[model samples]
Structure formats: structure tokens, C-alpha cells
Target: MTSLAEATGHALDLLLAGDAGLWQIIAISFKVSGSAILLATPPALLTAFVLAYLRFPGRRLLISLFSTLLSVPAVVVGLTLYLLLSNQGPLGDWRLLFTQSAMVMGQVVLAFPILVAMGHAALQSVDKRAWETARTLGASLLRAFFMVLREARFGLLAALLAAYGRIIAEVGASMMLGGNILDYTRNIPTAIALETSKGEFAQGIALGAILLLLAFTLNGILQHVQGKGVPST
Candidate 1:
């Protein structure tokens, strides 16, 4: 067995040498998670907008449902989707199981609630007068909507980054949906899980390092964005 220090050194060497296999796993993670976030974003923003600004029947119920979803475990999500996509399931004809699309679907489900919840909180923080003033100035409904969004931009951006961070690091959904296939759907988290399980600590540690760095970077960016929201004294 390789010593921990030796494995650490080798991991750094693999990273510095730009190992193709490692980068491929990273790329697949970006591709799947990126696609999921993009697909999830528009609807999340619209839903958050409605939840924050519109007074409708059962609105509170909807908000509570989304908040509840935020706490659901990732593996449970993976299991539910697994059954839905399995051959015995209704949607199985689409043959999406163990594919990147399946991974994207799982991630979209995981990300949507976070985006909606956080985006709603952000939009809710804006002064209602911002929306009214835009309309009072003779702006079209769509125009006024955008004006409100601009006022809440920093918060929305933070929500987006936070959602991205969650999906990118999650292993359960990707493992079940993507199958951790080499040179294919294997992503950072799934790859790390596999490597660690197989006693390939060097690769696991290297990938773990990447995720840590990514997390720090996202946190820094979130702080910066929130800072921009504050009035300069």
C-alpha cells in the first residue's frame, strides 16, 4: 500500500503533469452539471419571481413544498429517478438510463429547488417600490420585470452559484445515472467515490483537492457578489 504522503505527492504530480484521464473526468462533470444548471435556471427564476411577487391560491403551500425538497437526500433522488428510468418504468422507452442525460435530469431536480428557494429569498428582499416605480414610469410589464431583476441581480447570481456548487460536487445522482463510465459520464464526484472505494487514493485525493478548490472559489465569489449588494459606507 502506498503511504499517504507518497500518494499525496503522486496526486500532485498527476495534476501538474496534466493527466488526460483526470481532466476528462473533470470535463464530463462540467458538461453534465453545466447543462443541468442551464436547463434548470430559467424556470427556477420564473418560479421564484412568482413565489416572491404574486399572490395566488396555495402559494404558501408551493413555497413550503420547495423548502421541503431542499432537505431531501441525494441518494433518494437518485433512487427515485432510477426507478422512473428503469426498463420497467413508463419513461423507459426513452432509454436514458445510465446516460449523461439521465445525470442531467437528476441534477436538474436537485438544483431547481435551491435556485427557486434562494432566488425567491433574493427577490423578496428587494423593495416593492422598485417594481411599482418601474410600472409607474410607464414601463411595460416585461420591462418592469427586468428592472426588478436588475435590482436583485447580486442575490440571483449568488443563488445560481450556490446551485452550481451543489450539483457539481454531488456524487449519488451522477453515480447512479452516469454509471461512472470512463471517458464518458464519469464526473469529479463519482470518480472520486470510485477511486477511493478501489483504494486508488492518489486519484481520489487529487480530485478531492479540485473539489475543495472549486468550493472555496465559489464561496469567495458568493461573498464578493453579496458585497456588491451592500451600500458602500
Candidate 2:
């Protein structure tokens, strides 16, 4: 109990002191994950819109594929990317392994399906007449699409928040692709893993606290949005 108390105190000190290492890890985490989700949003949302609005053969199969990918383990993604980026791999010439870019790529893979699946759900839940109403008003195709998006904004925001939560908390892909390089590709999850391995309880606890805070804050806002009458599910 005494040791636990000491560790907690030390962890608080690390946070309160604004320890550079801790902050750097946090910053890199947000940087990579944020960029990844931002890059993925457009295509994912477009794909969702298409899937939700268009009728086509094999569409259900494709939707199922995206849903299945949502549960794929992070290490599996990391391993696949590792091979693709390795020296003998086809894309090896670009030499992107063990870098922040690689980490971001892994996160993109992680977040894409989530955004697509949830976005599709959001768009599909909207009243079909919304699209028709916009088009009947002689709105251009682009404007009609924007109208549908506006109607689904709350649910869309929920989807994005969920995606951000997943990528931010993931450890396997980040550790494998980022290489946990200090002052470089290291991120919150990877840094926490490293610190715990080294028996640095204070640093690990500090990082964990930050993660908990982020998770709580995100979930709080999510609940608030849902309470404010977003789409159910």
C-alpha cells in the first residue's frame, strides 16, 4: 500500500511538473492518430455515403467485410504492415518501416473501417426524404449530399469520436510500427508499455492517468452528445 501510494504521488508529480518525456509521448500520440483519422475521414465518409445511398451487387458483402475488419487485432495489422515495409517486401523501396508515418498508416487502417461502418449506420438511419427533399428543391448533387451530411452530423460526430478513441488507446500497431523510439515515434500506449517493462511505475502510471483522462473526457462528451438527441446506436 505504501509503495502504491508513493507511485501515485510520483505519477501526479510527473503530470503536474509537465514532464517533457511524458508530454512528448502524448503529443506524438495525438499527432499520428489525429493525422491518420483526418486523412481517413473523407474517403471513409464517401464510401459510407455510397454504401448507404446506392444499390449495387455485392454491397452487402462489402459492408460485412468492413464490419469484420473492425474486430481485427492491432498486432495483425502491425505484422502485415511490417512485412509490407520490410526490405524484401514490394514497397520496401520507400523504406517507411519503424517511423511515425508507418505508425500513422497503421492507425489509418485501424480507424478506416470503424469510421466507414459507423458513418454508414449514421447515414442510413436518416430519413430518406431528407435527400429527396433537397433534390426536389433543385439543389445540386453536391448540395443535396451536404444536406444529408448536415442531417447526420450528430451521428457522424459520434462515429468520429469512437474512431479517435480506438486509435488513441491502441498499443500493438503503435509499438510495432513506431518502434517506441524515444524522442521520436514513441506514443502514449507504446511509452506506457516500455515504462512498465522497465519497472518505472511512476512514469507508467502517469501515462496511464493521461490515457484515462482522455478516455473519460471523450466518453463524457460522447454521452453529452447522445443525450442532446443524437441518433440512437
Could you tell me the lDDT of residue 188 within candidate 1?
94
lDDT of 1 by residue, 130-221 (tens): 98999999999989989998989998998899899999999998898778899988999999889888888999999989999999998998
TM-scores for every predicted model:
0.97, 0.96
Global lDDT of model 2? 0.91
Local distance difference test values of all predictions, in order = 0.92, 0.91
Deviation from native of the Cα of residue 67 in model 1, angstroms:
0.6
Pick the lDDT winner: 1
lDDT of 1 at 115: 96
Off by over 4 Å in 1: none
lDDT of 1 at 127: 89
